[model samples]
Target: MANKKSTKTPAKAKKSDKKPGLIARGKAYMASVRSEMKRVVWPTKNELVNYTVAVCASLIVVGVSIAVLDLVISEGLVLFASLRG
Candidate 1:
């Protein structure tokens, strides 16, 4: 008895090749984005203002601290360099 091998046919390609226009797709994507934006919980005006003030104050404090530290280190290095000269 001889064994026979089964051969399978290849699948057919799809016929629908049409794509939507750029403007229509863009409008649809923007609409979805806007809807998602509406779902977000936004901060109150007072909270926003307070947070901004806090950030500015912290930044100023950090800037002043860094400046003082830099000046101290530079003066120390200069004093050491002069002593070595």
Candidate 2:
């Protein structure tokens, strides 16, 4: 008697190749964000205030310098144009 191979069909296995839907992706992204946030070492109150003041002072200095340069250049241009005319 010859041994024969079984011809029965195998059961279908579930496939996980599909991409996650929008809500699932959003939840995963938020979870990752929250996890990263937990690892942050935030600045203290004094450090925050010092940084704020430094930024404001730098801005004021830059603004004043730009304004003075603009005024000087404009006046010089007016004088040169008037002398030429």
Best by TM-score: 2
lDDT of each: 0.92, 0.95
As a TM-score, model 1 comes out at 0.72
CA lDDT for candidate 2: 0.95
Q: Compared with the true structure, what per-residue lDDT tens digits does model 1 show for residues 1-85?
A: 5987668777877857767789989999999999999999999999999999999999999999999999999989999889645
TM-score of each: 0.72, 0.77
TM-score of 2: 0.77
CA displacement after TM-score superposition, residue 22 of candidate 2 (Å)? 0.8
* lDDT for model 1: 0.92
Task: Show where candidate 2 strays beyond 4 Å.
Answer: 1-15, 83-85
Q: 41-67 in candidate 2: lDDT tens per residue?
A: 999999999999999999999999999
Q: Any runs in candidate 1 off by more than 4 Å, and if so which?
A: 1-9, 15-19, 83-85
